[model samples]
Target: MRATMAARGHGRRLAAALWLVVVAASAASARFVVEKNGVKVLSPRSLRGHHEASIDAKLATGCDPFGAASPFKSRSGRPVVLLVDRGGCYFALKTWNAQEAGAAAVLVADIVDEPLLTMDTPEEQTPDMAFLANITAPSALISKRFGDALRLAAADSSSSSSSSSEEVVIRLDWRESMPNPDSRVEYEFWTNSNDECGARCDEQQSFVSSFRGHAQLLEKSGFAAFTPHYITWFCPEEYLQTRQCEAQCINKGRYCAPDPEQEIGAGYDGKDVVLENLRQLCVHRVASARNVSWVWWDFVVDYRVRCSMKEEKYSRQCARDVVSSLGLPVEMVEECMGDPEADADNDVLRTEQIVQVGQGSRGDVTILPTLVINNVQYRGKLESTAVLKAICAGFKESTEPPVCLTQDLETDECLNNNGGCWRDDKTNITACKDTYRGRICECPVVDGVQYQGDGYMDCKAVGPGRCAVDNGGCWKGTRDGKTFSACAGSESLSGCSCPAGFKGDGLHCEDIDECGEKLACSCPSCSCKNTWGGYDCSCGSGLLYIKVEDTCVGKSTSAMGWLATALVLSCLVGSGIVGFAFYKYRLRRYMDSEVMAIMSQYMPLDSQTTENRPLREEAVQA
Candidate 1:
């Protein structure tokens, strides 16, 4: 019996897959250009993954529309945009088939001349639709008239093989699809917290987790405003008393959601999803009131991880724990949510319903996991980078921030291991700088001192003010109320050296013994003792050591005084002796001269007789 039931379930799933093959159309306003006969023709079209502004590729016709007919082969070995008639398969299956045949993109032309409609993915997931997730190539839907023109151009080019210029080319342009009317972009994310809804749920959760950083950055910097919305339906009045309504709705069936398990007695009912959605809405509303609306991302991500449906932990208690952990006001969120059991309208949930309707250029958001930027729907893979690029494109030219202009989003490498850069644990200073491209390691200037070195490994403080920061990364110590630093009065620009009385590289210094090494106080009467950063010396009791001369002197140094006084007396005595000798010799000479003059008065003195003195003798003779 169990085997039979399982086989029945498989058969139902297969039937659902077949039923989904019928093409469904959505409203889109993007346009594409076709080049034929040396002229460009513009036509209205709707493109899926409307992210890029323009994509140019050669046209290839008569490819399998359902991908089961024949493989698509391109002649030029370049990117080919495969054209097919819209009928045999789902839009997603067509795109997937073209992708498998090595087509860069696909354009499905409508059989009738109706307005262009968006080619969307299947609403429900099935085993046959498993290739939906791998449909990365962009696709579009064109009118019947444009399709015929492209076919004729291709036919003409193929028949006349001599001229390659006759080949048809088309350009998918989405530049004007999303308008950039202002400097700031306002976007809305239509999502649900139901984790059991399969691919759509997973996509929503993944986008929230990966895009949280960028969203918060844009919000905090005032570059963008983001709003999250959840879709809810009101049960019909006829089914109000049914078991489905009771299990799937709250507030007397006013707001409801499809049962997650799609069964009455299965795991989680629709009411559970609705309540969680209300709680998330309340979280955002409360956070926005507090002027920190970005915390909504934190609460959602945390709740998804801690309280998942698969783990059977998706309960009120788990959500409360997540809310409290993020410091959000639980009482405020509760008050905003109001009584789920009350038979009245919830102001928060009611507002969400009113905002769900189409307004201005945007249409009603009927699709799950939809992104609307600048009041226009963004149809593409719900990935972070792709969504970011579309949001950036919504900004006016030259009004984009550095985050948008950069090649990639900011990785915040400094948050992890300081980006493998140099850091001072004591000062909490790091050389890593987070930028839009990634992280860079460069020495930083702190206080007035600039650091110099290879920032990845080392950053040594330099300049006169370097000592103020970690003692210039040098060795320092203090003892007995005395402190010494190897960086004190340093003259070199970088590197460390031991101070005067210390030994070792400046990184690690030890006191030196002046007396032991005979470097100081070398006199016999001197003694030395090692200190923390230097040495101390003392002389014997009766001696004093001269630091300048590095010599010992007697304390009772009267000997130096006596030697000075003796030298002064000896100079005086020698002067007196020389004076006396000179005076006596002069007196003797005077006496001899007086005797000679007395003798000469009586007669000419023999010693005075000379040729010049002969006149005196002659006068005497006359």
Candidate 2:
């Protein structure tokens, strides 16, 4: 029994020696120094906020070391500052519950030999604890060495002093070591996340370029998210403002909380200026001139200021200066600088026109920035890459552009392989993925036809054409008595359509046979073969489709048949008419000669006739 007791006493002495050694080492590496009355103690850095709190309460070791207790009585009415060890629960939770139990502050001691660290509970890990916004009271972490020294001091005082008043009066003050600034430091939350990727990720590229300088500031600050301070101010509106904005603003005496009225402006509040510029340039100006992109590019690349938010006069001056500096066309500059609000009525009309046009084209089916291909709005992101993909899919004339085959963008459900294929207007052929069902090549089924493939492939073996029956054709309602299966990854069918061999609406389907009906073969007599939706006419040689009258009126092949037929008909008719006229004349002459002989016999030719005959014979002889 004596040997056991001796071993226990030796073990206690060794433990006490080890604690003293830890205290000596902590004093050397300690970064925070806490003071009470005149006694100074080393502490560690923990929690971020106002670095100091002053409370005059007798230190209390809560019933539970981690402060997980309902009520712990304090020796005085002064604010109670509890001494708690790190563990058992979240530091935030402990501080919060201790505060609820009427403690003014909770000082947590590290269990390890490491220096103090600010409490960090990521929401991803403890999803319920997003932020310690609820913790109003101050909480800090001190070194285990410091905690041990305090506990030892209290014990020593309790043993030596009177039994009724063995309490050590103390003060806890967190004095920050940062040098004082001339004025208050200000902060702002600004970002360029909404800047659009025009035609490409121009905005993103621009942001990447500008963010390079800020990388060091971010590293030094040791923040997970951007915290704007007074250091970063010159960044463009399209770029995020970090500490630089606040710093510059303060330097310029412009650092003030954003005025609500100023933020809520006249016509441009909450508007996407970059997107609006893209729309005006690509959709409007491009329609008029092919080289408009250069102007738009110059504006985005050179005009760094976001003048749209400025007052009218300043905006106009800035715009004019930019245009003059760029040496762009005067008319173009004038047109762009005209007051947007001055033409409010015109703006409304234009808006109405745009909406009306979109509605008419899409049958009131889609919203703004609609991606329509052959009258079908593509169901994809309104980004440059997605728009390019949709456009590439609509082309059935030739293979897709090289970019379409190789270009890849990060999609919501897709891991960008950066070497994938665009399948069709409706789907993209992406890298294979392991899904819940199984590993499968990523492709989409369109119009009831499953286009399963690993890489680049056609939407259909024989793609639809502009003239195809299903391309922009009116609804046939169903096919083969079954409902049309066009609902899958396709637009609705509602357009003009005609049956085979016809060239008009279904109601007025006029037969447009190229050979027989309209003599389109241009031959007098041609053999016509009617085919699906068309016909082929074989005329005798020398005959072809005539463009003049659009009729087949040629003669015989390899010969002039029409001319010969016309000659023969004209000769026969002429000869018959001549023969009938000659015969009538000859009969009339014979009847006249007989009538004269009968009259002469009935009435003697008078003597005057005999004399006239002799005279006539003499005159005739002369």
Candidate 3:
């Protein structure tokens, strides 16, 4: 009997040792540093929100169950991490209270000595618990022993008079929360298609809409690989034939979701959601096969907007319209989705269920819209910027993509109301410029022309090329197919002025009436008539108006006038004839001289001596 009892005692010891090994292996490895003594304590992150992996703040003890303690306040405007006991209320409520009191983070110390468990949002969401989705602070659960040490430190510091002992400061290091094994980051988004489920659903849709562009960018650049997932529950065998199962389960109770409106025989049933979920899953599969999986983001975003449950447009046809609009293979997706009436598992949805289970370091996906980066769950608000930051953190230190290093993710803010900046409706030119840091209200340079102004109210085109853009933002008019603008020639650098035929400020010009203003046709013989931009003038018969002198002259007539004109014409003709006769005589004399000179050169004439006797004698001597 003694030998058997000793063997049993040894068996118990061995079993306990094995249990410790299992617990240690499964526990999260994140830790925080106690600045006072340089001691490190294990504090695994537990909440889901935006975690500031690089956080250093002062620690304050506010053990009050209601979070009404004054110690929670930070006197120096430094970040305060509140330490609260674990049992006063729900874990989420504690964090909420701490958050309301302006605590940067909350640490819920376990009241009893036990293994640290993850603090999760409540299973059932209540109207008052709306704060769950808005919590941006990172939280963690620490061991009881460490909690005791922190509480003791807080007491000592508060009681002591030394400035150094006034408060305890620690740095919460979450750098290891996400594993960055390589340059490429692989992430998964667990979401649902039901948009009528309230805040969580709204958040999921918002995230998908806002982050679609960024996700597609990363995927196209090969910086990240993203997969989308949906969660479905299986109906129990006993309740398979019940009305609840009929309203929710699809494929004969194999997959299911809760009714969107939570009412029987009203609005959209839960099976509708399951079917849509299956369709979305197949969209990704079909797109992946075609090597254009990024289209999945487009389909999901478009479907959410075009086919929403609240709008009662969440049907198969609506989904097909979205699929077709994105140029996806509708038949292939239909084939992948299979039949929802079949009393068997869907190939695509079955795989989704298998992947939903925890593998490696990732835990089961229990929360709606959970983001898994590098096989580790991301904790933060479901915002595009926050989620993008978490994904960026998963890259190996220096291997982050350019998008990750940017200060802000591109939101395409210029799409809405032109980002509240000045715009020229006619030219479609805007002053809003979209950048990595959201939208900037600075004038834009378009087509080599720079705009100048405050950008928010008005932007005027400037420089030599300005006239080509919206006519330099100046007044312009068109009449009778003739268009006139206040802008000067392209060489004119800036400023607008009324043209020659119009008058007003540069922004608005009215055509000037030359006839009405008496600016033209002032001569008595001229007729005054106004045209669009100028005036027309006419003169009486036998009279001519000189435009340069702005006057009219009468035509001469009668016998005396005729005789004088004829005499002048006769004299001009006589002079012309005399000039021609003189020209011919001169030409004849010159030709005769040329002929005589040529004959003398060839043979001596009677009147011409061989040159001179002296010349002849010189030639003979030579």
Model number with the top TM-score: 1
Q: How far is candidate 1 from the true structure (C-alpha RMSD, Å)?
A: 23.6
Candidate 1 local lDDT, 508-622, one digit each (tens) = 9988877678888777777777666666777888877778777777867846867989999999999999999999999999999999878888876556566557797789999
**lDDT on C-alpha atoms for all candidate structures:** 0.70, 0.37, 0.69
**What ranges in model 3 sit over 4 Å off?**
1-78, 100-102, 123-134, 164-167, 408-622
RMSD of 2: 28.0
List of clashing residue pairs for candidate 1: none
* Full candidate order by lDDT, most accurate first: 1, 3, 2
lDDT of 2 by residue, 355-390 (tens): 333332233322222323334333333334434443
Clash pairs, candidate 3, are 49-379, 49-380, 50-380
lDDT of 3: 0.69
User: Least accurate stretch of 10 residues (summed lDDT) in model 3?
Assistant: 13-22
lDDT of the structure predicted as candidate 2: 0.37
Measured over all alpha carbons after superposition, the RMSD of each candidate to the real structure, in angstroms, is 23.6, 28.0, 19.1
Query: Which structure among the candidates has the greatest lDDT?
Result: 1
Of the two candidates 1 and 3, the one with more favorable TM-score, higher being better, is: 1
Report the C-alpha displacement of residue 287, candidate 1, in angstroms: 0.8
